[model samples]
Target chain A: MSDPILRLEGVHKSFGPAHIIRGVDLEVRRGERHAVIGPNGAGKSTLFHLCSGEFAPSSGRILLDGQEIGGMKPAEVNCRGLARSFQITNIFPGISVFENLRLAVMRKHGLQFTFWRRVSRLDNVTQEVEGLIERLRLGHRAHTLASQLSYSEQRSLEIGMTLASDPKVILLDEPMAGMSQEETEYTVGLIREIAEDRTLLIVEHDMSVVFSLADRISVLVYGEMIATGTPKEIRENPQVKEAYLGEEVAA
Target chain B: MKLRPFLILLAVMVLLAIPWLVSSSMLNAAIQMLIAALFAMAFSLLCGQAGMLSFGHAAYFGLGAFATVHAMNAFNGEGLLPTPLLPLAGAAVGLVSGVVAGYFSTKRTGVYFAMITLALAELLHALAPHLKGTFGGEAGISSFRMPAWGFGFGTAIEVYYLTLFWVLLAIGLLYLLMLTPLGRLALGLRENQRRLRFLGYNVHALGTLIFAISAMFSGLAGALQSLNIEAANYAELETHVSTVVLLNSFIGGVRVFLGPAIGAALMTFFGHVTSDVTRVWLLYQGIIFVLVMMFLPRGIVGELVERFSGKRPAGEGIRLSEMLPRLAGIAVAALGGVVLIELLQRVMSRDYRALAAGGQWPEITMMGLSWQPGSPLTWLVPLSALALGLALVLGVNRRAAARREATA
Candidate 1:
């Protein structure tokens, strides 16, 4: 239980002359809600990209369930029990919410090349998609297009897509970036409910939500990890207080 | 849903009765219509469903035609390949060529994908003339349909039935494909390939498969064409064939299942009828295409489907009662435009200019009417009709706008 399900070792990423993520090392333990918090331009999203196979690290190893997945394609990484959600609400916007969820779920049933059987008749995929829709509280909006979803509802849909793969390690980048206080609270509860059986590594800017939801928190500064501990330890640490957490904790 | 089934049944019955009702020459035109319709439907599978607009589909169509002809020559309805089963040769070649071409083309998306397909077809088109044995240069390869399964395979009606059967089978398979899991993924592929990638799907493989399937059916259509005509030529591989299918699919509305077929069939029927009467038929087709694009960008069937199921445009829009007059107004305007164009076409002819070289300005006969070029009423009458139609249509537009504003 204490072993890390996802570990990034000495990961360095550079585009042209500018270095984005510099020698970042982090570990997300199995079944633990871990949050990576940082000020703007702190390489927070870059770290997520590196883990989710969006970009290959210049020099490093990304281990997902004890397998190296640093330079693998996004699909292969997902197949290795790791999944990710984009910060900007990535989903099939033109299709219905049910169709979006089903597209994410049908892969698990080995229906990729399947042409004979009707997708509507797939009871298992339908049931799983329905379960996801209910769990996300989007039952009423199942028939609506994904683009028609409200801001927070789209966020939930993104998270639901991430969960559709039943991944062992889920990387969520700013799942609550743009939301009201009430919506954020609802999402916090929803994340708590879903993250009970899986490991979650979220990149969130909301300090209160981070404090309330994360079992352990890591603060990233200028493409490096400055601190990693519980919320109380992060608040009290002198080094952390002087850096990113000073003004937020005070407020 | 209940109405849809009944409508389909009625359509099928109408298709079945086509052989008995039409003349032999008209039946030949009907055979051409089915081939064009099938080609458009095959195009919809890729362009409409998968969202990959191919500009080189005729390459697959040509490949299928040539392959079928070769199979007929080699086997002659004796052994494994029968006359009825010859289209399988085309399907096999189409699938193989599709896979090869799709592998390279599906690597890119949107404009790049279209360009690659265009280039591939051009390559085949350029090479086809030189490969005499395969594409058969100049005169092209000709063959005869053999008798099999207790049918003589003689007469235009028999050929029409055979073509109709294959086309319907291909279309039915295409329609059923939409309900399948792979078909669902096609919609996903169209929606967002990046999202599908993260969902653990081999996006490239999926794209290639869809492209190949589309090509497979396109090839089947080609086979039907050559079988109907009893010949296959390198001209079938030309870029115009590709563009015609694309134009037909778009004009018919690729978004609907039967829209492209309807458009292709109607266009083909018009082509057969108009080409005999008018020299500027292609120009007329172009004008119609532009008009449809300007006012009805969704294509005819696409517009109809949206009007019925999709959200009403802006306000509730005018009811059918109000719409009838507006449609008549547009039809009147179109008639004026057509008269003006046809008159201008006749006046600009070399023969007309040569005849007027004597300065006689003699009378001309057109559209079953005699008209003197010296008469101003000829021009004024069409212009007035055009004005009246415009005024009527504009009045309806203003009324609809006023209604919407009042409701708001």
Candidate 2:
């Protein structure tokens, strides 16, 4: 494939004595949906954090669009067209839903430090914020304080905020966690719709969702990826079956 | 659509007319109130808006005061800037002090953060007395109010008007700042610092910027005070002064925009009235504090606004009927126990022979009981009365609670 959009070369990370990620090597092509799945304690979240620059790797490197991005701060990584959504909806609770999207857009438009001018007077910003709110199906709740929103609505708002940066690569950390079945299906559809034009790196635990949505899957066990393949290939692989799906398949 | 600005203008006009109506003493009081309001607003921005409670805000206030005083002294020989520009010097000094303090204090969070600020203020307090030349020892630095730059009036009213003009300008600027992206980010930081960092914002830098702004306003208030009083004393930097500012802000309600201003005004009025009426005003002040903490945790303005607007409470509200009786009873009992212990200790320490020789207390009769102020029995009576009062309250509270439970 034309040069990978993102490449992780033998990335290693550890917290104190616990070696969480042991030499992870992964790659994603442009416009690809790459899902990373693992058993508990497999360091899936740690890998995503490393990719998003929340934490630096112990060793090895990460590259985005053929440029080295390892060891950069989360903000620097974000400014370079890489956006991340938290596993547990990190949003401004007291402000209106529109304001939350506006913040991300303001940041993207390099207006983070524009203190002298009133934010409400930014016409183009307001228009863009309205459009994003409509696209995220949050039009009804536009003026509602974010803390007042339902859980599923918050997830949609989180995705909307992530999209505001117009990122080339989006890192979603368990976007479906605490979401009801209806919410999950809705989010899964939203993910597919957005993934058409941009690269997506998602860490999910639901195997069925992973199998159905991911273009390619990487299974991590004990901080090490034991399998990387299509759904069929992963299901049929003996090592993968023995390590993960063995009990479910047998039952 | 534009009624708010009209109302604000009307309010400003009324405030400007205050010196025309009120006495000079009250005008002086008003000026002090305006300065206190500025200081309280500065404190609230850090404590309320940013969720960074600082105990060393006096550092900036004192720095600003001293800077203005020294500037005034220098102007007597060679004028560096206009008198109106004195506040700017104070602002500059405040910014530097905030940067220095924030660098060390922002390294920690929560209680450690408060402790570090308190320790820094205490250090400054100690240094103020020792730094004889710069701080003017106990007497403090003073300057003559020479007429400069056309707006010269040899009256307290002119100074009050000038202070009112500055207060309005400073508050307006701070209000505008609260509506900015940086302000919103500071609020977000207060809610979730880690999340803000993860979102690619420099949480520390955001905090430092707000700290600097807070210090700038605090310095402005200090500069105004120096102009009003013609001196800057070590008392301005004391921990007690810092605590008073904190208490004023909290009792005023930190969350509301106009809360600090109202709070400063009320505190100034209370201080003036009580000091004039009673020598034991601090005891009354302590009692007011306990009552406020028990009943009106959000302060007068916060509670008033909530009552009128019917808005959801910012904090959990306790039903007074359930809590008040118990609280009052406990307070009375505690006071009684403390008094009883204190009286017993004093009586044990005193020698009867010495008391008689001193002619200290053959002296007083009240309600058919003759006793000296120095008599152990006289002190014991008050302590016993306090104990009786507490016991009665506790008994009533228990009976009430049991009755309510039974009715339920």
Candidate 3:
């Protein structure tokens, strides 16, 4: 990769005594669908946090499109064309679904800090939010409060919020967690559609979804990347099978 | 939505017509009510809309009042500025101080935020007497609100109109602020601080901005008070004043924009009436606060809004019918309550002029009618009226619920 969109070099994070991520060195090329799979407590979510600037690596460099974003604020990182969704489906629950999307769109257009003009009168923002709502198939529930939406719908809104920023890189932590099979299938399709022109990095548990979606895969285990290859290469890699995939493959 | 502008117009007309309808003293009371209402609304901007509960809001109001007094004095002494624009000085100081205080206080949220505000307010109150130059000692700063722009504010009524003008402008501007992006984000800040941060917003900056805006408005109210009374005292900065504003906001329903205003008007009038009737006015205020907290947790306007939240307006006149029976029940209950309270107070004090001459049977004047304190009939009438009013209230409530069910 001549210039990877996201690069983690010797990244290490520790909470007091316990080292969450020992040293993670990874590179994700532009427009590639990269998925990181790990068992429980492998610090997959923590790595996402570091990459998204939620937490700085204890000692290493995190580069987003060649700029070192390691000690930067999440907002500054976002402004540099990187967006992420939480594993816990973080969103503004009190506001309407349209308003949630509109805030994100406004933030993208450098309007979050503005107090002079009414947000409701911003024609482009309203149009873009409407377009996003239609694209996400959230039109039926556009006026409903974000909290009132079903769990799957909330996740969809989260992803929609991430997309509203129009980042060059997208980091998703467990996008399909706790979703019904139907919902999972729909989200997979949505993610695939969205990932066409963006660098997609996802941390997921669903093996079948991973096999189908990831253009390349990195297997993280015990705070390190044990393997990184294509689905075919990963499926046959002996180390991956012995370390993390054995139980999943058998089940 | 079309009816909203019409309703606003009607409200403005009524406010304008109040001078013609009421006596000058009543108009003075109305001026006080406007200032108190603005104070409450300013508090609500932070407490209700931004999810920031400030306990020492009187700090801003006091600072504003002091600033206005100084401005007025300057206008009189050196002609530095016009009397009409004195509130702007208050607003400027309030905004500056609010930003300073908010910057530190907003670092910690929830209970800590409330505590920081309380501490800041107490510090100002304690220092006021010592800062005799600015605070004017315990007696506070005094100034003459001179006539400006050919509008002679020599009379109380003229001053009232000026106040009305500023209050209307302040309220209108505050309402417009709610439509802005910053205002929307304030609501967002209240709901989910972490989420806002994740969305790339500086949550601290937003909190501080709202704090400053709220303080500015509060200061504006205080400046209006100085203009009205021609005095700015240390009492304005006391914790008691802060607590009263909090009570007014809560009772008005902090969640509703107009809730605090209604609550302020009610508390101001109630305070006046109770003080006129008895010396234990504070006790009466406490009881009302407790009752409101227990039963009408959302306050006067809040409860009404909650009841009507899900109901679409089928017709305008229909709401009046629904409210009439309830209002009647409330009126009766209030009348009964007031009569019983006054009679009991009179009996307990026993310091009435008629009973001062060692008379066993005290001649009590209840609503201009003579009553013998020793007579059983006197006690029975109030007690029976109380019971009757309470029963009617209960019956009316049940009917209202049944009607709601029918409509649903």
Candidate maximizing lDDT: 1
Clashing pairs in 3: none
* All models, RMSD in angstroms: 1.7, 4.9, 3.3
**Model 2 misplaced stretches (Cα beyond 4 Å):** A247-251, B1-7, B75-78, B313-408
The DockQ of predicted model 2 stands at 0.58
Measured against the true two-chain complex, the DockQ scores of the candidates, in the order shown, are: 0.88, 0.58, 0.65
Residue-by-residue lDDT tens digits, candidate 2, B53-160: 999899889999998888878845343456666777787888889888887887777899889889998999988888988899989998756666787636798788
Model 2 pairs whose backbones collide: A75-B200
As a whole number from 0 to 100, the lDDT of residue A205 in candidate 2 is: 80
* lDDT of candidate 2 over A192-251, digit per residue (tens): 988889999898887778889988888899988898887778888899888988876555
Give the Å error, residue A139, model 3. 0.8
Best by DockQ: 1
Better of 1 and 3 by DockQ: 1
**Candidate 3 structure quality by residue, lDDT tens digits, A6-62:** 999999999999999989999899899999998899999999888887898899999
Let me know the TM-score candidate 2 reaches against the reference structure: 0.85
Query: Could you say which candidate leads in TM-score?
Result: 1
lDDT of 3 by residue, B311-376 (tens): 444532246665676677667776777777888778777476446556566578868899887788
User: Please, what's the RMSD in Å of model 1?
Assistant: 1.7
